[model samples]
Target chain A: MSAALVVLRKELLDILRDRRTLLLGFLLPALLAPTLSVLVPGWTADQREQPSPVAVVGAEWGGDLVYGAQLEKLIRVVAASDPEAALRRGAVQAVIIVPPDFTAQLARGRSRIVVRYNPADQNSLFAKQKVFQAVAKFSLSVVEQRLQQRGLSRAALSPVEVHEEPIPAGGGGLVLSLLLPLLLAVWALTGASHVASDVGAGEKERGTLEALLSAPVARPALVIGKFAATLALALASTFVAGMSQTVVTALAPAAWFDAAARPALRAGAVLLLAACAFAIAAMAAAWLLALSFFARSMREANQYGVPLLLLVMIGGVAASTLEGVLSSLWLAVVPFVNVVVAMRGVLFGRVDPAALALTLAACAAYTGFGLLLAVALLRREAVIFRA
Target chain B: MKSARVLVRAERLAKRFGTFAALTDVSFEAREGEILGVLGPNGAGKTTTMRILSTLLRPTAGRAEVAGADVATSPQDARRALGVLPEAAGLYGRLTAREALRYAGRLHGLAGEDLERRIEGLSALLDLGAFIDRRCEPFSRGMKQRVALARALLRNPIVLLLDEPTAGLDVVAARTVRRALAGLRDAGKCILLSTHLMAEVERLCDRVVILGDGRVRGIGTLAELRGEGGELEEIFVRLAGAGSVV
Candidate 1:
């Protein structure tokens, strides 16, 4: 136990000296997005709403127009001289014009209207279509009213009703999917690498491992001590990051974003523990063993270790993507996959008991494998003295 | 109860690396309150013998013991009575000079009052000064060796293994390490030191073992080795050269 503490203290001190943690774990995920958030509303609002003057151009106009109150909030109608020039100058999206022939064509019920605009222009298509719909609707309403005055109850005009029902996505599952973009993953990768490479490869690299073996502590004790220190660093960082992210999500103002709800948080906590246990224990073990045997130095191990971190992250992302498509309870029993599934379930509120159980099983299996590797690596002289 | 005879005992101990024999049929003993030097050239099995005795490596053949506990069967007991400086310093590079010593001290069960006092006393003895607090990353070869010596002194164990303790040290640093070892001897600790340099062997060791080609060629006092009245190296070459030629 004392031996483990020594390893743990030494490891923690090493991690503290790294500059990458500040940016990837603490700063980027926690603070970067909200800083960029202030621009979203203004930019989107500018694209949709218009409050400018514009020219009105109509082909053979003779349509009575009626506008919805909600529609009026976005656009203003105007008749301008030289409508083409107005559009070119960015005065409006398009122009609406009534021809001099006007109501005569509507009276005869045989008049056709021509909508005119430059076909080559950027806004020409939408502008052409929306103005045309408005004019046609207004003309139909006028015809209906005229027919009503004549006491005709014929079925000439009717409005089509289209109903769209939004399928409810499982609670907040959709929101959790967005976390892939931010580097919420950097901590796990860095933590695992720091530990495995430092204790295993770093020892080999620095030529200190042989000295440690000479100590009175049992071999397993040395491994356990090293493992405990690494686990503490990994678990501490992850839990802190997880909780902080949760708080920021919970209290960071609704306009900022909605956090995972209570149920998801509960699930997330469970999955997080499962993921962390698998990642830290399994990764640390495999890493320590592999490093002890293969690398001559921490630098060499880093070269090996960094790629693994990336692979885990990439796997995490891919596994998260598989949430709806390919993931099963069995995958949850696997190491990296289990964490991803569990985290997805917790963050999204859609995971099942079977999946969580399977993931737990996988974590246990990997941990056992890790312990075996550690013992084997510790005993190998070929790995120990390569440096 | 007044006499504790053997501090280290090795019998027919051998270490083989594939087709190469690092050490063969190596056997020796250091009694309590003595400094025994195991001297050889590089790859002469000096470090290999030290490693096996220190419990860092399991011997390929036969058995050895320290403090009367067979290292093969009771490695922990051997280690409990041991303080070692591997041929390599093996100091943790990331830690400061003081922190490394303190950490080692803590592991050796030196804590609270005992730990602090041991640290300060050793620091003054080693002339560590404020350099104790500085990270060992930029330390010179001698500085690292001194810190390693301090770590070895942490427990003041019954048996001390100094492996090339002054391998790359300057004159001053070498004197410091030697002086500290002389103190340990005065305090009545068994010590076995491994070195390639004959001067270090003559300066610190009361008796020396001449090893060559993975076996001991001769063992005696410095004067006994220099019976012909020439340099110690010439005698060492004569013994090792004959072994290699044969």
Candidate 2:
């Protein structure tokens, strides 16, 4: 434990002193969520505030559907000599081209609305839905007026009742999914891996590991201590990321921008999920660092470690949102998987006790595996000192 | 003769790497208060020979013992007797000079008041008082070497393996190191140091072993090795000359 403390303090100090590492492991994840939820979606939805362009050609109903004294206030309608030409020329997005019998069919309640658009146009689907909403509202008003003229109340001629119910969530989850990459995983890697390269193969390469092996501590205890220190840094990165997310979520309007929107996360669940996330991160860190004993230099170890950290982050991201991919027991036992899946479950407010248990059990199992990896690595002849 | 007091011995010590021979059939003996300098050019297996004696590397075919324990059979015992200063000996770059020595001491089972007192005492002797609390990364080559020496000396082991101990040192720094080594020698410590500098060998060593092409060419005092060749440098060249023996 004392040896481990020596390693842990050194690793943490290395990480804390690096400004870029602080920014990546602690800063990026917290800022990513709001940017994703608010900026991206807000820009995409901005079109709703603009007046939709509609053009008519050879329509028996004229622009009455849009510019009816009652509807005129709702839509801006334009007349075009060639309605299809207007749409093709980009003069208008959608043109309501009425058929010749459209006015007679309306008297008999047999009206049709044809919306022509290029099949490959991406936004046309959304444009079509908007057109339906506006046109449908106008049709309903026409029906009500027609009914009143016939001296019949619309509600008295009603049909069967209908009701809609929401389906329960399959999994509750985390905002860490989006925010973690920038804050915790990138820059934190250097501090987290400081002792890993230096202690493992770096020692071996420099011929110093033998001096360490000469110490009285049991081999496993030594490994555990080294493993613990490395694991601590990994957990620190995850914690930094988690804290950043909490602060940003609290302050960001994207998380709670609309008065009607509420994101319900139980305080206990947040802590439970964060704890699980840290556990997985720690195990992964220990195993990955211990594995780096094979690298010949700090530079090589980092090259090996970066890809591994990336794999962990990607695994975390995939596990959080990809329950289907993570369903197998194999993935559940993978170190970073347990943390991500549990976090996802917590965020979605559908945390299953069985899944949480599975996550913890898997993390424990991987910890044992990490111990085994350390043992195997430490036992090598090269571990003492090597070329 | 104090045969029972002999601290280290090696019989036919040889280490091989595939087809290449690193150390071939080398042997020696040492007792309390003797410094054996293994003088050779770089890549002449001085480090390899020391590594075997330190129990860091397994011998291919040899018998080596430290403090009466076989390095092959009783490594833990060999470890307890050995202190190593390897080439480019690494220190935790982030740790202070004091912390570096203390940490090495603690690894050997010293701690608490004992650890603190020993660290401070070692620091004062090594002239590390000024930089005791400073991180070791920014240190000059000589400073780093002193710290390594300080760590190696902290344990007061029966055997010390110093590889290229005087390489790349400035005049003042190298003299400080030499003085510390002289003190260790005076204190009845058995040490094996490797050096490229004949001056270092002449100044500190009681016996010098010259190696060439992975084999021992001769072992003697400076005067004896230089008898026919005039000076130590001339002797080195004449002996290391490829066709001279082969």
Candidate 3:
């Protein structure tokens, strides 16, 4: 164990000095989650704040009925000889055509306004929504005015009044429940594999492995020590990524989530998340180390490692898609998928102790098996001396 | 000679890699205060022999031991009793010579002041003071070899298995390494070095083991192998079976 610790200390120090590994394993992962979280929302909000430009045909026909009081704030009226041409050329986000008989129809208590917009363009789609809201508001105001003139209550327009109260879904908001687990698996796999390849096949390529193997240290001790280093970096990356996402989620605009049902994580949930991250990182480190040991060179290690990375990432995505459906004891025993399910359960505040125990146990078993395989590979002369 | 202890022994060792014999009935011994040279051409099993003694490779049909610890059965003990410098050994480029030596020492269970002292002694012995505190990435081939050698000798094992220790060095550096090996031998350390360089054998080996096609062709003191005072090259050429040059 002490020998293992010494090797661990040396490998960690070597990893720390490696700028590429540090950048990929820790700094990049730390920055990626928060950057995406901030950027996506910021970009969306920017788009929402800008008014969409639209061309109005027959603007004078309906007067206030055509462009309602909320119309100016929602859209900018752009001049266009051909409204459809303008919309297709992207000069205007949408074209509002007010028919010559709109006023007559309004007086008759019914009217149809044709709002032309490109469905493929985001700006055009948003403009369409705004125009619809504006027309609906104008119709409602006309109804209220007529009702008041007849001495009827304004509430008559909404006779079957509907009130919506969002119930907390137990899983921290939908995005967090899905996004966090996928992020954890990706960070853990990438983080562990980065250092694992460097320490395992990199040593073999550099010719340092034979010297290390010739040491009095046992093969198990050497493998465990290297595994510990890889695991340390993996855990650090997952923790940083998780914390970055958490901070972003905490500081995010409440309007982004269901105002009535914000995902709140308790202390117990946090502990379970940590345990889940640990299991994921441990599993990645063990298997990645085995793959690295199987490879004879760093390039070969990467060739072997990338497919496994893609496999886990695809599994994470699939599990996230099937989140609720994957809350079974059987899924808890699956490798990468189990992590996604457990993370979802933790975030959803619906922790199943039996399933969680099975997931953790299964991860531990895989890790042990992987470490044993790595040790066995290290002991093999053919692997150690492979081209 | 009988009073001297045999620290490295390879008894009728045979190693085959899936039918191609790498070492076939090859055997030799190195005693205390001796530098036994295993002389061979490129494919003559020199490295294979070194690897077996270093506990890196297990022989298929025979046993090898270092200081009575069987390399096959008691690898940890065998490794503890010997220090190896393989032909392709490399240093951690990120580690300084002192750091590399200290790491090797710690692995051999040496620590603190004792390890430091051992490292300092090796640094001076191997002429590593010029680059002891510097990282190995920028070191020249000679400097790298010296540091690697220092790392191998850090534990002061009873037997030293070196495979072509000065294969890539310039004259000055090779001379420095050769002098160090001679000093270590005089200090009662058993050194078994493999080399294709005939001059290295003529200058340093107390006894020479000539290997060709995975079999021992000759084994004796220089005079015994030379057989009535021929050039070492002619003897090597004849024994290695590459045919004579003219």
- Which candidate tops lDDT? 3
Per-residue C-alpha lDDT of model 3 across residues A1-387, encoded as one tens digit per residue: 289999999999888889988798878887897666554764676666677788899888858855663355777788899889989999999988889998898888787778899999987898898787777778778888899999997787677888987776655666677678888888999889889999999998888988899999988999999999999999999998888887777777765655433557788888999999999999999999999999989888878878887888788878856655754798988888898789988987788899999999999999999999999999999999998
Query: Which DockQ values do the candidates obtain, in the order shown?
Result: 0.44, 0.35, 0.80
* Candidate 1 lDDT by residue in tens digits, A286-382: 5544554467877787787676667766767777566667658656665565566565665554557777777766767776677667777676766
Q: Each candidate: what lDDT?
A: 0.66, 0.66, 0.86
Predicted candidate 2 versus true structure: per-residue lDDT over B1-246, tens digit per residue: 255367878788888877889888887777767787786666667778877887767889989999899988988788788888877676766667787777788677777887788777777777777788888879887788878877887877878888867666788778878887888878888888888787787789877777776677777767778776576766775665543321
Interface root-mean-square deviation, candidate 3: 0.7
Q: What is the lDDT of residue B83 in candidate 1?
A: 89
Per-residue lDDT for B92-189 in model 3, tens only?
Answer: 88988888887888888999988888888888777888889998888888888888888888888889988889967899889989999999999899
Whose DockQ is greatest here?
A: 3
Candidate with maximal TM-score: 3
Residue B29 of model 2, lDDT score: 76
Ranking by DockQ: 3, 1, 2
Q: Model 3 chain A, poorest ten-residue lDDT window?
A: A254-263
- lDDT (Cα, tens digit) per residue for candidate 1, span B46-84: 888888888777889979899988888888888889988
In model 3, what is the error at residue A50, expressed in angstroms?
4.0
What DockQ does candidate 1 have relative to the true complex?
0.44
Model 1 score (lDDT): 0.66
Query: TM-score, each model?
Result: 0.75, 0.78, 0.91
Q: Of the true contacts between chains A and B, what fraction does model 2 have? A: 0.28
